[model samples]
Target: MPQETTDEPGVTRPRITPLDIVRTLVLVVALATLGLWGFGSWTMPWNIVIGIGAPVVVLLVWALFLSPRPVLHVHPFLRALVELLIYVGVTLAWWSMGSAWAGIAFAVVAVTSGLLAGRRALT
Candidate 1:
């Protein structure tokens, strides 16, 4: 897909690089794991609901707000905010599940990938 850059740094990279694709895939995994965390965090009946709902909600939010040219077509700042929310949400979800190391590791990777991706956009 063709790409257009915004005034922000790293917004101008090619439509998708290998790193970008991998980062995106990893984010999806975080979302999925977050769903599992949600499921396990709750009681029986609620766990079932959370397991099914959490990932679906995250996926929809990503598609609607974070994805490029999403259906909502939000402003760049708003898009970035939504993306941050997702990233933080997943990170916290992991932490809340008593996986501090996993949370920290994912946060480091997510932040690094985000910075690198943004830097790539700037070039």
Candidate 2:
């Protein structure tokens, strides 16, 4: 019998690996940040901060897990696009929820995603 070692289909599907999860989480954090600001502007209680901080904490965990250990080589444009989409989607969701300062946080996520774009997709 052979050992059943296998990698997730993230190689092609672009959403099977920890990196993918981290990328998506980046976007979620952007949205959550916006929501947090919105809640704050509305004079909401400090307890509500958790709703926004949750995504950032999750993003950190996923990022630590997603950072390529030895490093993989992915195309620059494709990498940027994937990250951009994730970041935007998450921010947009937050904006839709009527976050007062969500757009500002969205910019931060966009910049972070761009910075992380140097990572290569697993071939």
- The per-model lDDT (C-alpha) reads 0.78, 0.54
Stretches of candidate 1 above 4 Å error?
A: 1-16, 119-123
Error of 2 at 30 (Å): 5.3
Instruction: Give lDDT tens digits, candidate 2, residues 31-75.
Output: 566455445444455436655564565456335443444144355
List the candidates' TM-scores in order. Answer: 0.76, 0.37
* Error at 46, model 1, angstroms: 0.5
Per-residue lDDT, model 1, residue 41, is 94
Error of 2 at 52 (Å): 17
- Window of ten residues with lowest summed lDDT in model 2: 64-73
* lDDT tens per residue, model 1, 1-123: 988955786666555678878678867887788778878899989998888888889889878976655789866667667777777888888889889888888878877777676566457
Model 1 is weakest, by summed lDDT over 10 consecutive residues, at: 113-122
| TM-score: model 1 vs. ground truth | 0.76
